[model samples]
Target: MLVASNRGPVTYSLADDGTLTSRRGGGGLVSGLSAIGAEADALWVCSALGPGDREAVRRGVGEEGVLMLAIDETVHSDAYNGIANSVLWFVHHMLYQTPLEPVFDAEFRRQWASYESYNRSFAEALADRAAEGAAVLVQDYHLALVPGMLRELRPDLRIGHFSHTPWAPVDYFRMLPDDIAARLLRGLLGADRACFLTHRWAGAFADCCRAVLGEDALATTRIGVHGLGADAGFLRERAHRPDVEERMAALRAQIGPGRRAIVRVDRTELSKNIVRGLHAYRALLATRPQWRERVTHVAFAYPSRQDLAVYRDYTAEVQRVADAINEEYGTPGWTPVVLHVKDDFARSLAAYRLADVALVNPIRDGMNLVAKEVPVVSDAGCALVLSREAGAHEELGEDAITVNPYDVIATAEALHTALTLSPEDRLATSRRLAERATALPPTRWFLDQLEALTAVG
Candidate 1:
């Protein structure tokens, strides 16, 4: 069996002595693999992402069962940052302003070529390692073209592709150049099964296939949905650690007295809606002056993808908004918005514990785990203010205060409503959200997908 993704379970980093040390990577994919590690004879194939990773590839350091493909830095950047993150991610999330961006000129075609080459590298690696009739699972938007490339290399292999982002509707999906759009669809259709995080995303992909490849294309490949749920037991134990406890104390002091806490923990991803969320916090202050000094918005906007200019600009915008809010409503005794850009797991858990209301209002997400994780880790049963566009909303919406991600004013009102909810109701809702969120644990989710793939063979 083989698993291929742009990222892998482990990454290498250089130390002061210039020795490369490997560390386990984070994310649900890693957790899922961990669950089935004992039973499966699996090899992971990924690209060299950083300097240390490149060095590891050069030295032939195959940490765990991984095969590292060291692509040229320029090619990797064009493929990963250009085509994958900037283009495919934007189209899928509907984040592009449309008129101002995504002009797929000659440069885009060049990057598209790099994207194809990058996916092909993984395909070649998998074909080299996979046994006869082995099952191969390719992951995410970064490697959407891998299945088709791999199918060309080894048609005997049973291949499945899982998309971890929302799929664009047919109209929006056609935003790509005609050739690029057709290539992506054909690439994915080469798989025996195509999987999405939610039925909404799966249906969108199916619609696009029918629109481009005609109605009969569905008969060639099956579509599956597996909304990856949160790991409740792991979160519960980790959230209660002494490190998290220490962070909680520090956060409490920072939050101060006589003020309730409104918490948001997110990477500064474009689709996270951090800027609008901050604006909604300001709106909350403006419309309700009584709560101005009585509430603190603890925004843990951790830096993500700083390599790109757009992500850097978005991150700066988030800080600017937070500063603007503090300037507008702050006093000597009260800071309305307490924003932190550092990535701190313990601090995030602490914020989850102290939150009076947990705000997870992404413009679009495959699944916002924070919406589910917060409920499982809340010390006092925090009310959840979630975006309906989030994939997790399908499972957590009934218990959460759902709001339109694009509507800042509506979100502001929902925040207030969430904050004022009765304690009994908050507890009940939290209980329900936690229960449903953990219904499909990481192990089961991975196994279910694998089991479904076996049916394709």
Candidate 2:
């Protein structure tokens, strides 16, 4: 089986001694497939962006089994950032607020051409590596057109695609020019089966295919939902490491006593609703004076998508808000906000363990895994204040306190309620969440997809 995605399984980084070291990826899909190991002769095809990546790819440098392919910069940038991020991502995540007007200019068309070229690159690579009857599973918005392109090239191959983001409703999706939407739908229909993170997202995709591409498309397309879950064993082991313990001790020392920790770990991106989340926290402090100095918000916002101007602006806005909040409500004895903009997995695990309240309020997300992870390994039963917009809401709604991402007052109230929950209630809720988080492990997820693909074949 060949799995195609925008990012590879291992990323190469230059070490202090100028030696390249490969770091394994962390998502549910990666961990799930890794568990399957040699049983599933999985070949992951992904693009490489850096010089080290190019060198590694050219020299055939990587672990024994995985195959890495690096594409040119021009094609990757225009296709990935322009078409995938600017066009498809906006359509799927419902990022655009202005429904009345959308800009589809010459640059968009140019980028769309590059997007097609990028998809073709993957198609050609996969077709070469895959056996005559091998199954090729395509991933996410980045390579939507690859399945169809590959299918056209190799008629005997079985193809499947899974969208890791929410599928926009027909009304919102129709905002894309008719030809663009039709082409994308037709591209995905090249697959024998399609998968979504939730049934709601699946239904939305089906509706789009029906409304945009017609009922005839349904004859070839079968949709399924595989709700992604956390890897309990991996998270549990990482949570108890010495590095995590040292970080936890450092956090405790910094915050001092009688202070509740509200933690949010996210990439600094426009869709994360980070500024709004901080605003809600500020509202909590402003409206409820009692919580002014008693709560500390540990925001672990690492930089993401620095190539785009909008993301850079969003990152600045998050820092500005964090600074403003601290300036408004900080004493020499204790700082109210601790904003760390660097990516540190150990530090994140430490934060997860120490979190008294986990705030995962995204504007829209396929599934916020942090919502699941915090409850599983939290020292004190962490209260989750989740956004209704997150895809994880379907599975963890009962135990979580759901909030509207845009409503600052409601989010503030929810935070207050979460912080004030009794110890027994918190523990019970956390226990339920931990059970739900681990109910569907990663190996089960991959096998279920394999089963669906096999049934269709």
Candidate 3:
């Protein structure tokens, strides 16, 4: 079996002492592969994403079962930041400013060329490594073109493509250049199976294919939905670890005593809707004055894709809003908002365990794992303030206080309702949410895709 993605299961770093140190990677793919065990005949084909990765490639130092492609630095950046992040991400997230943005100029054409090249490199590597009739799984939008490219190279292989983001509705997706849109649809169709995180996204992709390439475009490709769920066993065990326990103690100091916590942990990505989430939190405090000092919003808006100016601006805006809330409501003994920009997994687990409510209101998302993860590890039952747009809402919405991502007032009201729920009700809801959240663990999700892909004719 072969796995292709933009990043591998591990990263290499050059230490100051001139020795290279390796760090294991995190994410569903890594966990799924670990569950399968190292002895399985598998290779992870990924790009050399950093200077360290490039250096490691140059030095002929690499981990077994991993193949890192050393594409040209400039080409990598153009394909990564310019095309994948700037174009595809915006289209899928429906994030374009519409009238003034996404100008497909000369530079865009150049980036598109590089994007094709980047994907070609992956396809060639997979072609080289795979045994005849081996299964290949291509991951996410960054490598959308690979399935088609690989099909041409090795027709005997069973190819499956999994989209990890929300597929844009037909109308929104039409915003892309006509030919480019067709290419993307055709690319994924090259696979015997095309998979999405939810039924909504799968339907959207099918809609796009039918609309763009006519009715017969999907005749050969089977669409599947696999809503990735939380790993309950891992979360339950890890949340009680010594480091998490220590971080929980530290978080308690910051949160103060006898205060219920409203917690959110997210990277400051534009699609995450961090700014609007903060606005809703502020509105909650402003409207419900009695709850001012009784509750604290523990928001961890970690930096993400900082190399992009828009993301940097968004992260700054998140911090600015958090500060404004504190400045308006903070007292000598109590802070209304305890915000952390740094990313810390142990600290996140601590927040998850201590949360009274978990706020996961993304503008649009394939699946918000944090929404699924919080209930599994919550020490005290946590009410979920979920966005209707998140893919997880399909499963968790019955128990969650679902809100529209764009409606600040409604979201604030939902938060209030979540906080005011009786302990018995909260615990009951939490139990259901956790059960639904882990119905299909990561290992099961991965294996299901693999099983279904191999069965495809």
Candidate 4:
């Protein structure tokens, strides 16, 4: 088996003292690979993101023996920021402001060429590495065109493409140039099987194919959905560690006395809706002044993609809003929003354990793992204020206080309701949600997709 993605299972970072340290990758891709990535012949192929990574690529060294693609910095930037992040990510997430963005001019065409080249590089690498009848699983929007490119290069391989983001509706997706939209659908159709995070996203992809490439395009590709669930066993064991225990004590002290915590763990990505979440918390404090001193919003907004101006601005806005709320409501004894920008996994797990409420309200998401994880680790049970837009809501909505992510007032109201939930009811609901959330562990998810790919092959 071979895995291809823009980011690898591990990345290298250089410290000020000139020592090189490596960190494993996060997210579903890495989680899914934990079961199979260590096999003797398996190779996880990925790109070089920085100078350190480029050096590693030059040395042909990586974690778990990954194959690194060392494309030129200029080409990588154009493909990553210009096309993949700017164009494709915006389109699929329904993120474009519509009037001010998405101008597909001559510059866009230049970027599109780079995007094609980047994908072709991945195809060439996979073609070189894959054995006879080997299964190639290409991940996410960054490599949508890879299946077609790899198929043209090596016809004997079994290819599958898995999308981790929501597919835009037919009308919203057409915002792209006619040629580009059709090319993407055709590219994905090159796979023998195309997978999505939910049946909703899967059906949306099928709808796009029929609308853009005609019905014949969908006949050969077997479309499927495998909603990846949390690894409960892993979470249970890890959350109980000494580090987590130390963190829980630290977080409780930070939260202060006689106050319940409202927790949210998110990157400052646009789709994550961090700004709006802060607004909701502010609104909740404003209207329901009773919760002002009693409830604290312990938001973990870790920095993400700060290189992009929009993301940087969004992160700044998040900080501004959180600060404003704290200043507005803070006293000698209490601060309203306890926002943390630094990334710390143990602290996040600690917050999970101490949370009375888990706020996961992305405007739109494939699946919000935090929604699934908090319940598994909560010490005294938790009330989940989930967004209907999040894919996990489909499975856990029955037990959660569902809200519209775009509506701050409604989300504020939902927060109040969640905060006021009966302890007995909250624990019962949290347990049930935890059970369903981890029904399919990462190993099962990987094996299922592999089994499907093998059966077809």
Candidate 5:
């Protein structure tokens, strides 16, 4: 078996002493694949993301069963930042300020060429590494072209591609150039099975194929949905570790005595809607002054895609709104909003365990794992204020206080309702949410796709 993604399960860093150090990654994919055990033969093909990675590749030093391609830096930047993050990400998330931005000019065409080269690198590597009739799983929009490119190189390989983002609606997706839109659909259809996170996204993909290439364009490829779920066992055990416990105590101190916490942990990505979430919290404090000193919004907005100007500007706006809220409602004894910008895993787990209400109101998301994770690890059951637009809402909406992501007023009321829930009611809802959230563990999710892909032959 072989897995291909833009990032692998491990990374390397250089030490001042000229020695290299390696660090393993943690996520659903890593957890799922690790459950397969070391005995199973597998390889993870990924790109070199930085100078350290490129050096490690050049020196032939890396983890066994992993291949890191050191493509030219300029090519990587154009493909990664120019096309993938700037263009494709915006289209899928429906995030364009359409009238003013997204100019598809000569520069875009050049970057598109680099995107093709980036994917071809991966395709060539997979073709060389795979055994006869090997099953290959390609992950996410970054590698959307790999399936088709690889098919042309090796017809014997069984390929599966999984999209971890919401597929844009038919009308929204048409923003791409005519040729580019058709090329993306055809690239995805190259797989024997194309998977999405939810039925809505799957339907959107099928609609796109029909819209771009006629009604029968989807006849050759099968569509599947496997909503990834939280790993309860891991979260349960990890939440009680010493580091987590220490962070939990520290967070409790910052939150003050008898104050309930509304927690949100997310990267400051455009679609996360962190700015609007802060607005909702501010609305809650303003409308219900009695709860002003009794609650604190603990937000962890870790910086993401900082290389892009728009992302940097968004991150700044998040801080600006958060600061404005704190400045407006804050007192020496009670700070209404407690914000953290750094990325810390143990600290996130701490926030998850201590949350009284978990706010997962992304404008659009593939599946907000935080929604599922908080319920599993909450010290005292947590209420969920979720966005209907998030894919996780498909499974958790019944138990959550669902809100329109764009409606700050409704979200504010929902947050208030979540904060005031009786202990027993909150506990019951949390139990149900956790049950639905873990219905398909990460191991099961990955294995299901693998099984489905291999079964086609």
Candidate 6:
């Protein structure tokens, strides 16, 4: 089997002594694949982003039955970020304000050419490496065109594609120029089966294939929903580590007595609604003065895509909002908001363990793993204030206090309710949440998808 994504199994970093060290990836997909390393031969074709990655790729490094192939810098920049993030990301996440006309200009056309070249690179590589009738799994928006391109090269191979983000509604997707939309749908149809994270997303994809590519294509295209879940064993084991304990203790000490923690951990991206979340926290402080000193919001928003101007601007906005809230409501001894814009997985687990309320209110998300992880690792029974738009909400909705990502005042009220619940009620809610969160572990989720694909064959 071959696994392909935009990022590989390990990212390289230069050590203090000038040695190159590779750090394993953290997301559920990486962990799940690692856990099942003995099952099959897996070759991961990913983009080489930096000097370290390029060096490692050139060395033909192989470990844990995983092989890494890195694409060129020009292809990655123009295709991955320019077209995937700036174009398809907006279309799928519904981030654009389309009241203003969206132009498909010369730059977009140039980037589209790069996107095609990038996908062709992967298809060529996979074609060269794949055995006859081997299963090839392509991941996310970054490589949507690979399945079709690969199929053209090697007809005997079984091709599958999975979208890790929401598929846009037909109306929203139509914002793309007619040619681009048609090409994307046709590209995906090259796969024997395509999977989405939720039934809604799956249906949306099927609808796209039907509307854009014609109903005849739908007869051959198989769509499935594989709702991704957290790695429960990994979270549980990490929670028991001494470093996690120490971090939890430090966090508790900082919050002091009689103050509950409202926690959110996210990449510093516009889609996360970080600034709006801060606005809601501020709204809570201003409107409900009684709860001001008793609560602290711990927002750990690590920098992401710092090279992009929009992302840089968004990170700055997050800081400005956090600073403003602290200024308005902070006491000499107590800060109303503790904002850490860094990526520390252990610290994130510690935050999950220490949280009184886990706030996962994304404007849109495929699956907010934080919602699931907090319930599994939380020391006390923590209430989850989840956005209805999150893919996780479909599974955890019965236990979560649902809120719209746009309604700041309503979300604040929900937060207040979660923080003030009685101990018995909190415990009960937490028990149910933990049960739901861990019901489908990552290995089982992956196996189920594999089984479904096998059945399709």
The TM-scores of all predictions, comma-separated, are: 0.98, 0.96, 0.99, 0.96, 0.99, 0.96
After superposing candidate 4, which stretches have Cα over 4 Å from the reference?
Answer: 15-20, 26-34, 37-40
Candidate 4 per-residue C-alpha lDDT over 356-456 given as tens digits, one digit per residue, 9 for 90 to 100: 99999998999888999999989999999999999898888999999999999999999999998899999998999899899876778877887898889
User: Cα RMSD (Å) between model 1 and the true structure?
Assistant: 1.2
Residue-by-residue lDDT tens digits, candidate 5, 1-457: 8999999987888877867778888886787678777876889999999877888998999888788899888988998999989999999999999889889999999999999999999999999999999999999999999999999999999999999999999999999999999989989998999999999999999999999999999888999999999999989998899999999999999999999999999999999999999999999998988889999999999999998888999999999999999899999988888899999989999999889999999989998899999999998899999999999999999999999999999999999999999999999999999999999889899989989999996
Report the lDDT tens digits of candidate 6 across residue range 84-172. Answer: 99889888889987787467899889989999999998899889999888878889999999988998999888888989998899889
lDDT digits (tens) for residues 1-457 of candidate 2: 8889998778887666768878887676676677777877878888886777777777778876567667778888999898888878888778876855469889888889999999999999999889878888899999999888999999788899999998899999998889989989888989988889998898988899889988777797788889888888889998998999999998887666878999999999777898999999999999998997788999999999898998899999999999999998999887888999989889999999888899999988998888989999898789999999899999999899999999999999999999999988888899899899877777788778877786775
Lowest lDDT 10-mer window, candidate 5? 28-37
Model 1 stretches astray by more than 4 angstroms: none
Task: Kindly provide the TM-score of model 4 when superposed on the true structure, using C-alpha atoms.
Answer: 0.96
Worst 10 residues of 2 by lDDT: 93-102
List of clashing residue pairs for candidate 2: none
> Which should have the higher TM-score, number 2 or number 5?
5
After the best TM-score superposition of candidate 6, give how far the Cα of residue 144 lies from its true spot, in angstroms: 0.4
1-457: candidate 1 lDDT, tens digit per residue? 7889888787899787889998987666677677676568888888888989988888888676788889888889999998999899999999998778879899998998999989888888899999998889999999999999899999999999999999999999998888789899989988999998888899999999889878898887999999888888888899999999999998888888867899999999999999999999999999988887888999999999998898999999999999999998999988889999999999999999888899999999998889888888898888999999999988888888989998999999999998888888888888888898898878788878888897775
With candidate 2 superimposed using the best TM-score fit, by how many Å does residue 170's alpha carbon deviate from the native? 1.1
Relative to the unseen true structure, what is the Cα RMSD of model 2?
Answer: 1.8
Q: Model 3 off-target regions past 4 Å?
A: none
